[model samples]
Target: MATFTKANADYLRNTLQEAVVKCSERCLYQSAKWAAELSVSLPTLPSVSSSFDADTDSQMQDVDPPPISPAFHFANNDPEEARLEAQDLSRYLLAKSYFDCREYDRCAAVFIPSALPRGPLSPTSPNSNRRTPTKAGKGKGKDSGVITEVGSEPPSNALPKLSQRALFLALYSKYMSGEKRKDEESEMILGPADGGSTVNKELVGITRSLEGWFADREARGLSGSNQGWLEYLYGIVLAKGKTEEDAKRWFIRSVHLFPFNWGAWLELSELLNNVEELQKVVPELPQNLMTLIFHLYASQELYQSTDPIHKELDELENIFPDSQFLKTQRALLYYHSKDFDEAETIFSALLHADPHRIDSLDFYSNILYVMSARPKLAFLAQVATATDKFRPETCCVVGNYYSLKSEHEKAVVYFRRALTLDRNFLSAWTLMGHEYVEMKNTHAAIESYRRAVDVNRKDYRAWYGLGQTYEVLEMHLYALFYYQRAASLRPYDPKMWQAVGSCYDKVDRPVQSIKTYKRALVAGTYYDQGSSFGSGTTAGEPTGVLDPETLYQIALMYEKLNQLDDAASYMEMTLAQEEGPEEDDDDEAGGHGIGVTTTTSKARMWLARWEFRRGAHVRAMELANELCQDGVEVEEAKALIRDMRARMESGRSPS
Candidate 1:
């Protein structure tokens, strides 16, 4: 266990791989490969290395781990190409293992730029660990091996000059290590309570260094080798910072130079914040397969309607028919639409086909949670946690399961753990806010909601949660802003519109309230009918189920503005939708669910009053009598009856 060498690393790797196969643990293989790469003894724990010759490097280069066929997700790649990729993957097994282990510092160290070790170097050379290049005359090259850089230049002539994968890994590992180190420092300085910043201050330092590195390379007439990847990483640093236009430029450069890189396309897609931005950026994107896929993903995220996007996805499937990525995209599109049933079906198939896949199971859990399928969600949580307990997604699934059980405290713990694992976990922050709200910890909920929005402003739930917390505190003005933001993000969501309408009413802006309520009615009917039609009409012509409270509010607003005829008409519409009498304490209030005291009796009472005002004494009397019998709005009903009776007796009514 103390001293390590090529043989010791090989032995340990075989042992670990055996366990991986036996347990069917895919992540374990990654762990084992990384472990073996770092198998050389550390001075603190292991004995010194023995003198090894250059032949070891060539022998190790020839040997590769057993090939694992890339899944159908990469079916787009040719078989020959896939084989080459497998070999390329094994080239840096040691560093890859460290990355999988989350040892970013160690991972970066393995790929740091250094002078190439040519056929020979001085014995006193700084890199004594590097092997002397063996000549063909040396027969011992077959048996004697030595450690070298995991991700140096290309392992084969066919690959890119700089080993782009290794270079990106090296740079990204350093980037992530900087983030980790900064977080540690921040925790020390600001304490955990104020830690987990979304600012990412360390990125600035890396970005500056990358700028200098690129300039030096250009000045020295270096080959473009990893130009695209370097640009992609640079774009990442800029994207995370506020240099919006600069980020876009580099992402474009990255995509143009390396059209096959999915990350470049994805980062560009995320940079587009709105449908307008998306459409504008789409034209700028080079017309390629990657752009087409990015277009589908971006469309799913923006424009709320997925009907057209489904057609687009179907078209893409024609090209990549067996692609699991496309299938998951379709599933994700459904999930975004809140069409849980369809989402559930597709996700279930995807999971069944590849149980070890970890991309979107947290999303599957969310769909189940929304559907109140507790047992299914619980099973998903268990499976996700078992697959990779350290993953942020797994923690989110566990958190959701606990949340469903009404275990708010446990839910918060898991969500916080998810945040600890990945501070940028959008779902964890939003869900944690929900848990805090359930616990009535408004301050904590506010912090979580803010952090969620800071990570990704597109998450409407976080905006809505902030509104809910403010509304609970009777901070109507603040609630109005957040609700409006949420509504703007999810314009078709009835609940968001209703919340906005409710806020307007609370602030006594009846005109605005009436307008918003109408929109809510349209959105509700539009969503319920699964319409592929355009954004619902603002007039809110209900084609299906209607919110009677919204109707009642419209009447109340009309009444307040002295539009008596309009008031009576809306009040009658409200009465048509009412199922039974309600015991209302107030006379003119509409009991909408968002922010009102509502009772069925109030609608009846208001209708009766409106009828009496129009000189319909007999109609008013009948409605008032019913309200009195129902014991709701009794006082208002009695007064209406007496007024009608007196007016009738005076021969000024019921003619």
Candidate 2:
């Protein structure tokens, strides 16, 4: 648990240097073997010293040997080259060790210029150019083809340079460490005195360093495999701030450079709005990358038919026949496709193989519920609750089963347990809200939904739940706000649009209400026949007939606006879709009394009023008489008839 800091710099430096020396010795030994095989006399490498000194002046000097004859030649004796290669290899080892130890800050700190010296031989020093002379040699000898090992001192150009790849990793480590610290600090600070500012500052510093490295690479006109990674890292940095477009551009460039990069592909896929955008890149991607894209497609419900997904899954199965991840994905596709038997079979086998697989258990419970296999679902819930009570998914499945059985109190207990396991479990929060709503605890429902939105703002279900709870409480303005948010998250969901419209009407925003209703109609019709099942309703709920109640409300609004013709048109449409009244069973129930009213009677009353407005008094009077005799809207019918009579007596003839 020891933290990395400037105090530990010496130890870090010494450890890195030792690793470099060891790797260099191994490389030299390999070169010597190669030299022997080539029939060349390599220089007898000096014994690697056990101790290393950071200060140059304190180092023991090597004994200078007699110069070799012209016939004897040494091969590969560049000390600077060996040292540079050794430093690169050593960096990898050191980084891996630090990463394994979870000391990411130390891993990053080791690659900085101040910690790792840039130049072993300083050009500013006069001794840097000086060469030691042997007892038998007075001046420099003629140039020979022989390569000899230099002493421990490196040449002026032999700088301890860090590659951009290493620098990128350093930035990544710093960013991850900073984020972890930020989360921890956020949890500790009650009053919130901005403890995260320090972490943000660290992130900013790392981003600036990456930018500087990118600029240096550009100026040097360097383009290679590392270029892709550099761009990808830059994209990650840009994504941290208000530079999402720039981030996207850099990710695209990274993809162009390295098409095989799964990281870049995944990031790019997230930025895209739809599957069409993904299709443009699909052909260029490898099969493994295609599987990732297909997974995205499946998540978005972009596949209209299972054919394409099944084809892709077949290809993936060939590549990784025993991959549980792929098998689960295939099962999910089957579930979505409404092949419950197939989905259940695969999920059951997966659970049998790994009983503790929470995801499998969750999905299996869902499939069982959808299939109405109540006994199976209850058994699964009991087993999961008993064996894996600590798992959030297990609690969620148990809670869902109880909720379905209309046991709201028992359901809330399990849902709250799931939330206790992970406060940010979005599904549990949303489901708990549903249970609260069922229990008629509107305030608790609101709190649960608020927590869910806090966990993930993009979850449309949480926002919709908040809207519904607020609307039920007659908080129209608050309901409107959350409904709009839900609509933004799921624009294609007609239910969200309808909720927004209803809120608008409640708040007296008639024009906005009308527009939103039209949008709801369009959205409802667009996917009316699609097989995609939403949580709000059963599969393929009839959308051809507009909500009769909504149509009637619209008609009333039009009447208020003095748009008589439009009112009549909408009322006619409502009547056309509305079902006729049922026969009164006078023997079984209390007879149809004076106060009784029916949907058919209401439609007739509205139609009669519209007829009166259009000067069709005869038809209006006939409908009004029929409603009054049937004891349906009797008072309203009498009032309408009285008005028609008064009008006729006043000589207001039919127009």
Candidate 3:
């Protein structure tokens, strides 16, 4: 008989119950090991049988006799009952063995007998049926299933389905089990066992049922009819498999099936960056649908697929003509497109409609500076300037407007004010550094850029500004490092490469300068192609503007070595691109460059001189006459044209 106090008995019983619920092969094996240990420690009863003679001086009478129960009696005298009990225990042992080996099928097969015990009176029991087979020859294999078949119904449908809550309990029971698996030898040993803990069996059962239900549901979902659902499912699976192309295909399919769903469209747009896909789907979508989807997608750090974003403004214009959101989008796009006039018009309209539209004012000011419209930039800066208070970013934007307008002192004031509001504002620090750079304050600029980098090391503009400051201070190597860092972040920026090439030129490496210039041209081609002005800049189409200054340098190389005619032709071609103001007061001054304060008659006179030297008398005369008629300080132009024409008229040209 086992000795037990109230606490000890409760603890042992609770521990045993917990072990049974775990049912893992490892847990079962561990429990059997514990049972084996306890078996050796059990007190064996003296086998005197029913013939207890007086000569047998046993202490059972002297000491308190233990209570006898049917359980103890079955273990002692009944050989047949003992044999049956032994068979019942064999199922648990076999189940544990199968489970430890990860033979789920076999483990489940042996687990049935342990769950459904059999006795002589039990007709539905496997062992009972085995004792007496009906004429139908039932119960052929007792240990071959998770449970005996319930009247030929499918296994899934036949089993009682558990709910999610019940499944959770089952998982928790497995997690809390004190036993360690063979594979988990590195885990810590459990402190002690508890037996009397009554786990909520109902919860566990419900959980198991729910797990089975979800598994069935998932299986059915695999053959789902909805294309969107199927695509989403396949996308997740393919993504897990690391097949990005297959994942992309499914993502696109999901968008095709459900264009209106924001989540689906965004997810597909992110993975499948095919601009043609967006272009095809955008027009078919309802108004504002694309906007909602893209706003969510733009949250990623790397800004991929700019085509959809660039087209969003056009779509918004068609949909919400007078909407504030549409107006802002158009303003931003126009600013990027360098259509400052249109951007100004839109932003002005927004301000007229609502004076408190701060974003319109800020973007309007930025476009004004970028377009070199100084007067308008000043006006808009004043418009956004606040008497009460402003956000740090807004103040930084205002400071930049002033800085671009060459008002460094005023820019510094606003930049300082912005830093006061938000000390960690990286853009403000960057703008302030640029202002310092303009003011030729290299130390101040360096310190400002340092503060900017402290706030945000990834800010390419700040790094570029810092590099520019170093370049100005004649620190070529330091400038190179900072410029390289900035270029890595924004490799598409041609200006950055040009700056890098200039640094090389500063260091007396002309060949390296030439190489870097070529690299810049390549980047410029790519950047311009993707830019709003791509078609004209990259496709050999004319934009009525001179070739870039870097290209002009190459043209200069052609100018050297007495290529006077070629130089004059290129210079004239460059000059021809300079359009006069459309609202000119007089045609006599019609050819003056628009927006230029200085007269370009000097360049015109030089071309005329070049023509005279080349012996193109008639062309020289024509240019000379135009320059002389304008009274633009062209000395002896008439005399030169007359002399050149006279020489050409003669058989020999003038030397």
Candidate 4:
């Protein structure tokens, strides 16, 4: 047996005390193991005493020992008993560390034995007969003395509340890992766990254990910080199980109590979509982390101007003067701000520093493509394809460059390769759909868009693509369904509303078409008002100059509904749009004559016929004469003229 010497006792006491004070789980386990191996009784650490000097006392006032949890207490003074207690504590700590690192199987193995009661063994103990007979003896059956029936035995050791909690967490981790693997294989975004039977059991166990812990801590009036940590973990579990709102409430409560919890801050930022809110609590976070949050905000396009992003980047640069990551982020901010030239300059420097930076490569390719720098884009794509062929983003960039060049077949190959590398690459899926649409493969386009939606249902682009594909196939019902879904997801998008309105018209629902077109006009008006230049329309105009095509469609729908007055009103609006300042030069020729000249001719002839029917002889004659000036409508105008002249010559009142 090992002797418990004074020196060993002192070393164990100091190490354990320090471990407890630092809250270092790994160090605690090591110290506990050393004490058990040496059979040393740990001495109680002395209480911190105030210094006699007033100045020193004030400085040392906050140096008191950390409070120990009840689970960490040793009830015996006997050396042998203390050694056993230390061994148990070491097991607990080991189990906790494994759990924290997400090694669930190891965590479960260590925790089950440490937590459950262990009974003393007799001659017929389960451990004694644990070994099975060899395979050769299997054919001999019971006569060969092979162990068969394994009976359950009661545990001698009582389970601790903390151990029970750890056990539940281990099981929960295992369940979540399984779900994550499934999501990866299926190319779905990682989100809340599906309610599988096994997962539900684990969730129930975790919830029960957590509730008990909360109850116990509250009853004992424990430290609020510890309770806050509990809440944070509870929030994580709830979030994994798809209870987002519930999880958000818990995260808010956690940060309120423990303001320094960075994990809580990050989760809250995502839930609220407001990184600025986190600054109120964690003002002194590391510059790298702060820059990352700002980058995330920029990526989400949350800021209308670059002022706020530039300010944050400037502050970060001041703190981390030589940080390459911050420099890359600054370039990204420039790109988001639409300063393409400045962004290109910064990205060029970054790529020069590290030629293989994937993010820089991705963003630079996109910038060059947007700028119509075709030669540079092709060069970058070629170099990236040669060097980083396996990277999904590289493949995607190459695919995009080819797609821009109208090389649809070659682009499809690279896009498919990107998807093979990362099935949930939403951009790849969407780009592939565009390629298929360009190739005139409506079926393939629909499939690609469907896959995109399967990966992320909230992807409005995917829904809109599906709607377009269906509309092209003349599947009005299907088009209407997807267009409605897309509109719901992005109600501010006028294009989606227009698509819905067109689908209604195709299905012969003129009233619904009118309503949908009106909705589109309202959305367009708001969009223009919110923009600096009215999105290519006259600033501050009512309805903000709706798409000429949309206006024509609305007029046609009104004609179908036999509301000729409204139809004429809308036709006049359409003709006026063609003569607006933004009119294309091609309108002078008949090449792009879908606007004023052609549409107005048709509208005028229809209006004349309607006026003649309504006994408005003068108005009908004037409209007919205007139509007669155009050779294309001369015969129709002459026929209308003859009818109006005959009606007037009868001298029977215009009707």
Clashes of each: 6, 0, 14, 7
Off by over 4 Å in 4: 1-176, 183-223, 227-237, 254-392, 406-424, 433-458, 472-475, 526-545, 581-655
lDDT on C-alpha atoms for all candidate structures: 0.64, 0.58, 0.48, 0.58
Please give, for residues 584-639, the per-residue lDDT of candidate 1 as tens digits: 67834433322112445677888787687777767888889988887767787788
RMSD of each: 16.5, 19.4, 28.8, 16.8
User: Over 4 Å off in model 2, which ranges?
Assistant: 1-103, 106-170, 188-201, 227-231, 257-263, 273-458, 462-485, 488-491, 528-536, 541-543, 579-605, 608-655
lDDT of 2 by residue, 1-655 (tens): 1222222222322322332333233222222332222122111223222222222211112223234334332222345434544566577568746755778778777675333221112334222232221122334311121111234222221223665445555666666666666555545211253222323335445544554454344344443324366677667655554355566667766666544344565565555544555566555443333234345443534323346667756644542345566678778766654567788889888777767556657667767766666788887887787777789889888987887787889988888778666655767888888888888899788878887776555566778888988999999999999999887766665677888988988888777877787777676654442222224233443424555556666776677677878878877666655432333576343222223237557767988977887778888899899888878689988998998899889988644
Model 4 residue 610 CA deviation (Å) reads 5.8
**Residue range 1-655, candidate 4, lDDT tens digits:** 1222334334334434433432233222332343232222333333322112222211112233335444654243344435544656676677667767767556656654332222222236333222222222433212122222334321121224443234344444544444445444444222133112122223434443454455444445443425355566667656645555656667766655533344555455444423354444343333323234334443333332346667666644532344555676677666544456777788878767766666547667767766666787787787787777888789878987887687999989988888777765766787788789889999778888887876566566678889888988889999999999887765655677888998999999999999998888776754432211002222232333556667777999998998878987887777566445454477543222234466667767777877778888888899899888765588888998997898789866544
lDDT agreement of model 3 with the native:
0.48
Ranking by lDDT: 1, 2, 4, 3
The candidate with the higher TM-score, 3 or 4, is 4
Kindly report which residue stretches of model 3 are placed more than 4 angstroms away from their true locations once superposed.
Answer: 1-308, 313-327, 357-361, 370-390, 397-407, 424-426, 450-464, 476-501, 509-543, 548-551, 556-655
**Order of models, best TM-score first:** 1, 2, 4, 3
TM-scores for all predictions: 0.70, 0.57, 0.40, 0.53
Kindly report which residue stretches of model 1 are placed more than 4 angstroms away from their true locations once superposed: 1-101, 110-167, 186-202, 217-227, 529-543, 578-601, 625-655
Better candidate number, 1 or 4, judged by TM-score? 1
Q: Candidate 1's error at 408, in angstroms? A: 1.3
